[model samples]
Target: MNSVRYTWPEGKKCAVVLSFDFDGITPYLWRSRHSQSKGISEKEQRRFGPRQGIYRILELLEKWEIKGSFYIPGVTAEEYPQAVEAIAKCGHEIGLHGYLHERVDELTRDKIEETLIKGKAAIEHIVGQRKMGYRSPSWEMTEDTFEVIKKYEVLYDSSLMGADHPYWINQMVELPVQWLLDDAIFYRYVGGGASVNPPANPATVIDTWKKEFEGIKKYGGLFMLTMHPWLSGRGSRILALESLISYLKMDSEIWWATAQEVAAYHQSLEVEGKNACLTEMIDR
Candidate 1:
């Protein structure tokens, strides 16, 4: 196996990124686009995100004095403009998710392009600036998606899990994420046919997060935590997140940053022709 030991800003041992997918009810609408059922239960569950979960998350970040990256769909932004405005006003980074939380793998290249343009425009209109990053809906990506990503000149993508840290994918930086670090997998229980099991205990989930952060720090890489307001915004879950942040704060070697900041720092490194490539190893 071969790897490159990337150096973080200020010679920090590991970079920590707190990112949120502020999906609201966009994902539900997308999934039920073809269904005739007028189910209000699931829709209301998802709405909890924009209505209350997001604000709780914002408060948590403010308490910690750290900025976070929020990826929101166009429909979500349009539906919850106040939430989007509050995020921007709080000085956090907002990135495009999709036009309707549409999965890139299910759409054609043209459709993907359409989503990108609309999503970007919708978010930029509220935030009053160009968005610098994107996280594919459902973390589904394809070559077609990458093409549109380049077309828009997005600085980074958080959908890929190719590496434990940020790496170059052509001209864009890939701020990789893992399933274990995402709260949706653990806490997203919408009930009915969509939900499979009960939500995991927040304590259990926090233990896993703490372990992963320690491992990432020990190995010197990025600790990118992907969370959803609908899932992690609950009171108990928020407390658990607070505990995790407190644990991480005890470490002085961690460079806390938003995804865009990490990507910008990674881009500044001359990975192609300099000592920025800290280590490379190959095993037979």
Candidate 2:
């Protein structure tokens, strides 16, 4: 397979971006089509994210002195301004995650633009600065979504799984994400009419993550971990995240960064007219 040879800051072997999707109750309401009565239980379940899970995650990141990228929906920020404020105050990067966690593929062009504007404004209000990154709700984006994001001048997007390395998406840097690296695939569970999947073993999840990091280290690529506070903030699962953070920190060669930092670095290289070399590698 084709590979990309990229150099991280300080000549690090690999780059790792720790990110969280702070959806809160917006996803539940969006999935239920604003039918709060039908999704009350689900909404409350997701409410744990803003109420408790985010605090736990924030505390963990603070303890490690690691700043993470947090994507928040407009409605989530509006409803829980204090929680959003706390994240910004912690020196973490906040990115856009939509106005109500609406799937971009399902919305029209106008709706997409509207949500993008509203989401950006809401996050900017809390962070007191313009957000430069965006991760589509549910990791689903339409073709028009690209145009919409560009119209808003978003610096980078993390919704695509095209490659493990950072690549260009028109004017925006594409910091790719993968399902295997997302915590929702392992920990999402809901009752009633909502879909449910069996949670994976925390040990196995962390083990897989460690192996992924090893691969990135070998190839000198970017490793983006997509997690949600509600899913990974549970008592047991949070331990796995803490362990993973500790493991990554043990290696001084790993360049830890937020999504915005990664994007800026890539942009700097592009402006310098430097190209990342593509090579083929054989696994031993």
Candidate 3:
């Protein structure tokens, strides 16, 4: 027999989860849009500085005929409630990204608890739902974050690059932290990481993304990509972002649901202990 034994989620058609993280709906960057961000360090400010990025993301989703998840911070909702309304009106899922998009590196357990609680309250008050998903900033999660997530009863967390597929949370496997993310691949991260520039050209980003998308098609699984409204909100990058949508529209078999839908489906299957079929079907 071949030594390359396939695990549970091998070659499955993927279920793509298009997730937008903190700073999108929030107007924290509204001022930056008007003038050059002065004095502030590039790394420190870029995280929250994307006022128009939201509009561009909305346009991209509409073009793709896809619905996405928006994980906003508590301060974001408290600050820009109109964007919260717009997100709901546009028919997208809203999740929590904490109160200020603060990373675990900078917080203690008490602070994380305080911020997360505030974030949930602000999002629910504005978006009209107890947000179901949570993503830590920069995927820089601490041990405390997990305990807090479990405490809040979040359906799933998407900040980790732990797998190439959406494994059942708490199920324990070598899997992707996020099923789809645009940060490292498209958006530039500090320290000149992969996000600094995608491995290929702007046009190629979609091509590579589609290659992954096609893998999901075969396997019947999910694709989770991250994007920032600031960069993709304008210029040639718009074409780059839109191309993925253009390609996704070609396939009708794909179900463009929120992260909640996927997590719920998998969790329910696991609870009833019908995981074998679910796994095989998801793996396609």
Candidate 4:
């Protein structure tokens, strides 16, 4: 497992990017695409994210005086215009997620391209400008997905778990993410005979995050946290997140930045002859 030491701006030891996937209820809808007997329990729970959870998360970020990157689906943006607008107005990065939280691997190349165009249009219509970065819905991508993103000239992608720091996937910057740092893996639990287990305790989860952050900081890698507004918007989870934020802020050597900013810096590095090694699959 190799890592790239990104030359973070301002002589920081490492870069920290907090990204939120504002899916609203799109993930639920996408999951229920095949069944007509879907229950409302999970759908309503997910709706709480846009309707209430997002605002709480926004306020928390405002209190910390830190901006986060928000990747929103087109349907989520159309459904929750106010929520999406608030994020942009508060000086956060808004990136494309998908049209309806569609799984890229499950779609054809044409469908993937259509979704990218529609998703970009939806965000631009609401925010008055197109963004540079994109995160695939459900963190799933295919060969066609990569080609479509490259065709659109997206600056970077945060869906892949390739390197610990930013790297180049051909022309696009890859800000890798891991499931260990995502909130949904720990806190998204909906009942009604659907849940396999209960959600993890927030304190325990945050402790694990802190340990990972320390390790990443020691190794001088990127600590990119992927979270959901609906899942991490809960009161206790928010408190846990704030605790982590405060703890990280105690060390002023960390470079806190948006995903786009980090990607741009990596691009700058490439121009300065700091090219990231290309990754590819080889026959076993």
Which residue pairs show collisions in model 4? none
**What are the models' TM-scores?**
0.94, 0.92, 0.76, 0.94
Steric overlap count per candidate:
0, 0, 36, 0
Candidate 3 vs 4: which has more lDDT? 4
Query: Local error of candidate 2 at 65, Å?
Result: 0.5
lDDT for position 81 in model 4: 90
Alpha-carbon runs more than 4 Å astray in model 4:
1-4, 275-284
Mind giving the per-residue lDDT tens digits that candidate 4 earns over 1-284? 77545567888989899999999989888888888964677888899899889999999999999999999999998988989899999999999899999999899999999999988988888889665689999888888888999998887888988778887765678899999999888987888776788999999999999999989988788999999988999889999999999999999899999999998888788778753343332101
lDDT of 3 by residue, 181-279 (tens): 474455553343423443336776677777877765665545777766554555576787777776776766656677777767666556667545435
Give the Cα-based TM-score of candidate 1 against the true structure.
Answer: 0.94
In the range 28-132, model 2's lDDT, one tens digit per residue, is: 779778454743666777888888999999999999999999999999999899999999899999999999999998999999999999988887777777747
Candidate 3, number of clashes:
36
Q: Which candidate would rank higher by lDDT, 1 or 2?
A: 1
Pairs that collide in candidate 2 are none
Model 3's TM-score against the true structure? 0.76
- What global local distance difference test value does model 3 have? 0.64
Task: Quote the positional error of residue 218 for candidate 1 in Å.
Answer: 1.2
